[model samples]
Target: MEHPILFISIILEKLGLPVPHGFVGNGLLEQLCAPYMTYTWLVMVFLFVVSKMTLGNLEMVPGGGQNFWEILIGGLDDFFVENMGREMADALFPMLTTFALYIAVGNLIGLIPGFMSPTSNLNTTLALTIIVWVTHHVIGFRAHGFNYYKHFIGPMWWLIPLMLPIELISNVARLLSLSIRLFGNIMAKETLLGILFMLAGAFFAPLPIMMLGVLVSLVQAMVFVLLAVVYCAQAQEHAH
Candidate 1:
């Protein structure tokens, strides 16, 4: 079945706005802008609204929406500090948290009856991978100048001949791997659930798969966030 959200996302592109176009539309700018809509922008809007609504009022003890959001951000902040150090954590926390939340929401969006999870589309995932790749490598080169190339070449002059191509291939593979893994898993899960829903009219029968859907959603989010953390760390790594 053709996903309706994918179509709507395409129509948004037709108006010259940015939206993802996997199988929906075909335009250079549409392709370029699609990821922003499919994942990043959508996620950002959700996060912003949720955060503002949740934490609109600061409280000494916290309750309800404020408490929930505080716990979420606080937990994420702690994770970042443990992984990336206090200063870096403080600096990158917002971006990292935003990325995670976006991917998570994008993944789960498919679970809704009419909407499709944009992350399940290969183009969407690839676009996100490219964004991360560019951002981190740019930061690395900016910080370390020519030394950032060493990440691809490895340590020791002797290893360059053998390791350069290997490392280069690995880096490229990261994009493909990240994109495919997310696209395949989410798409497959949704497909299976879709089939089961069609086959079984009983509500409880599909509940298990829906539960799995939630798991896949969280896992995909974690994978994206984890990769982002690794990229950020590598970009900011001490130069050899």
Candidate 2:
């Protein structure tokens, strides 16, 4: 539990706050989201309330805090709409926004001294990828009915026998790619920063690299959201 990111966990562990069997006394690795999960949940709730306050308002003009959230939502809306089209973007807005908020927050939290990004864990990223993967296909089915599999069956009927397994494998590979990409990037940044802090100096030498880690964190979050938008756009092609 002594890895640099688990500063909060060390305190909780010391207080005997109950570890789940195997997590007991693991120095290098602890549960992925035990202490951080509660913080992540609270952050989500805060964002939800902010969304309601801004979006649910009848006011034609936004106030200060409302304006901040509006800009974020509006900018992200435009980003997705540019890629996915207005109709599909509008339809998938809630899911896209939720993904952006959670992943962005999760990634950025890793920059905090005592906190770990859940996105750094393969299981968490895989769960999210699976959700988006299943969701888009479900939307595809709803939009295209049985015709949805047409995307997988290849553009030519004669190619089904040759293309089917290839298509299926590629589809499944998306799960791995999405999860591994997020986990690998975040974990690399986290581990690199820890090493820099240790080897560089006892103090200020790691600051510049840590600042770059902030940029890396935000970019990773954006890349995840952007990919999700692309997948949704591809799936809901019927609406166009």
Candidate 3:
């Protein structure tokens, strides 16, 4: 049988929805939408239901899924405190939490049958990169006023010409790196699992690949979050 996730994507395409075409062509908007919209909505619904249940009763202690979610959120809350500091992190926590949970859930859900992770799509990753790009600069400008442009001048007025091109290239490269790394990891894992199953024809053969998939999923989420934190830090630095 074909990869169920890929098959679902094919179905979506036939229905005239956007999905990722990879490097092949256009018409692959679902790659972006899957992670950002469909999967995100599912995560949100899950969160809402859980919130209603858990917060419905004021408890000093959490139990079951509520406990698990509380721990997870607490860890993330601590992470924001450590990295983003108090004020900035407080201000940025919503966006950070949303991005982290959305991508993490998307990655984990790909392990389920008939679901492809949207982060595996280059276009989706690129769109995310663009969001990061815009957010960093917007925050920077808001914090530092027009002097945010000075980041490119290398602390010297004479260096503007050279610094501009270098800074531009570096930022552009971040987008390319973000997109390509995610696409390569996900597509390659899917391909490797398929080939392994074909060779062994045994369930055990694919187990190793799935384990690796778990690692890849986690690492990709971390990479994304780390970059976001760095971008936010940069913006905050400029604000100072």
Candidate 4:
């Protein structure tokens, strides 16, 4: 199938940069300008600008942007604290917040015309999953030192033979689960919207689906973060 031309691709092509006319090819330049990568960069820039605008000015009263950000951040902080005690929450808050914001924005960006969701790509989702997986394991090691390995061993010594492999397999499976779940949902959402747009032809018929897409995007982001929090919290727990 021919790839839909994105506004970014047009701009890049006009600027004399190489951009493949159809689907992303194997070339380095094509991969760099792939729809998902381009939109991902756009989402990152959008978030950066919004963050600066929201956080640049400080006021005693805290109206407008300050009030909005405080409420959002405070709510997220409280949610994390409730899930995993204060210390762990404090340690993981920034990373978790970044995950939530980035995933949420990336997922939602697909609903906009000429944009694609970064989370819809397996590479992007896998990258995020790997980061989360490594982070929790590192936290586990920090929290429990070498004893973190005890987590893989069962309560009794003999059970270690069976339990160790089981634990290892399950942990590894998390990598696949996290990445595939997000990628599948967002990709399906994007596909459905594309079909709807083709059928409806710029009409309001897709509005309902778009609204549901928003809910799906938020729910998926929350689900991903919630699972990450659970994994991190479990890692910090003392081994039986």
Candidate 5:
């Protein structure tokens, strides 16, 4: 039997609906999965559409889409400011917001039947974690210059040997933890949803499971964003 989401996409295509699609090929699949391309395409299209819609016309009275974007962006800005302070938040807002949105969208894309969340893939999560790791250090360096390394050093001169390696290991662990946390949660959600759907078939039994998957995706995205903010905040932290 055909998958429900694939079947729906097929029906929509037959009806001439313009659902975003990728050119399926093993060459593309060898390096990058179809969902990764789909997610990337969606993000590009989202940016283009938003730019065209809001551009210079953003005014006292905003359109629905602009208003929604404002609410999302504004809320995130406020949250980051509260955690990281105004100056740091201002510097990182664009990157943070972009990552959050991309991840949220990537997670949700899996619910569309044929598409799986690119975040479920370890490669995608590792790449995201590395970006966050680098950005956090950049913020740290700008905030404290060479003294940023001082943060990794122990409180005392003698402890530098002990503390530096420990700190280095801990930092390396963040890369693993961030990537694993994201990849594991997303993969688990998809696995559970697939199993539930297979067992329950078209019945309402799997409906709740589907909703659970959506909740998992959202919570995981928020967790990932919150952790990123915390990491950035730590990197910029001064005064011990």
Candidate 6:
């Protein structure tokens, strides 16, 4: 079935940039004109505007926006410290927080009418997984220098022949795991909600599913972040 063309795609089409109506298409044109790309850009711009508005006026006495942000930041900081130790968390706080917020928002946005979740796209999820994969490896390298490579090598030299390929495959599996998990969950949620809306019409019929979607969105985002932290923590550990 042809995927529904988003409002953003229509806008782009009106501007002489016609986007393909299907989820899969060919080449650079497909990548550039994908509806998910438009939604991803929308998510970015929404985040930027909201962040600017929230952080623009920083008062000594916190109001609603300031207080909410402070609580969120503080909570995330403590969570990271508990999971990955203080030093590592301090180094990773900003990036991890960005990932959490972006994923959470991207997932939830699809619950709104006339919008879609970028996280539902394999490209978006795979890009995020790659970032996390690179980040943890970089952290490992920085923490242990050349010794980071030792983690992939078996403890006993003889076992290297067997363990090396296994370790390489295991690491590669993380990329697939992270990307597919998020993409599958979000896409499933979107599909379910769409089906429910279609079968039951726009009334209160989809309310229950919408509520569940909200919970699923938050849980998936938390799971993604938690796994990322664990991966980074494991990376920094001394090879036994």
Per-residue lDDT of 1-240 in model 5, one digit per residue for the tens?
Answer: 224354434554676645445423256342333445545666557667866877547777888877887888889999999999998888888888888888888888777666667788787899999999998899889889988889888799898999999999999999999999999988887777777777785786667767887888888889889999999999878836
What tens-digit string does per-residue lDDT give for candidate 6 at 1-240? 225537888888888875776775577876687888889989999989988898898999998988999999999999999999999998999899999999999999999977899999998999999999999999899989998989998798999999899999999999999999999999999998877777775577878989999999999999999999999999998998
TM-score against native, each model = 0.81, 0.83, 0.79, 0.93, 0.81, 0.92
Better of 4 and 5 by lDDT: 4
Whole-model lDDT values for every prediction: 0.76, 0.77, 0.71, 0.90, 0.79, 0.90
- Model 3 C-alpha lDDT per residue in residues 1-240, reported as the tens digit of each score: 343445555666778877654333344554444433455456567667867887787567666767877888898888878887888888888887877776776676666655656666566677777887788888888888888877766657687788889987887788788768876787677667767767784657888778989999888887887788888778769421
Clash pairs, model 1 backbone? 19-34, 20-34
For TM-score, the strongest prediction is: 4
RMSD of 2: 4.0
Candidate 4 accuracy as lDDT:
0.90
Name model 5 segments beyond 4 Å from true.
Answer: 1-29, 50-56
Predicted candidate 2 versus true structure: per-residue lDDT over 1-240, tens digit per residue: 225646656666687764333322344334532654545665678677867776676466768877887688889989988998888888889887888888888888877776777677676788889998998898889879988887887778898998889988988898889889988998898777777777764777668877888888888788988988888778878532
- Residue 13, model 2: lDDT of 69
Cα deviation of 218 in candidate 4 (Å)? Answer: 0.3
* Model 2 pairs whose backbones collide: 1-27
lDDT: worst 10-residue window of model 6: 1-10
Winning model by lDDT: 6
Query: What's model 3's overall lDDT?
Result: 0.71
Task: Kindly list the per-residue Cα lDDT of model 4 for residues 111-205, writing each as its tens digit.
Answer: 88888898998999999999999999999999999999999997999998999999999999999999999999999998888787777846877
User: Which sections of candidate 1 miss by over 4 Å?
Assistant: 1-22, 26-45
- Please give the TM-score that candidate 2 achieves against the real structure: 0.83
Clashing pairs in 6: none
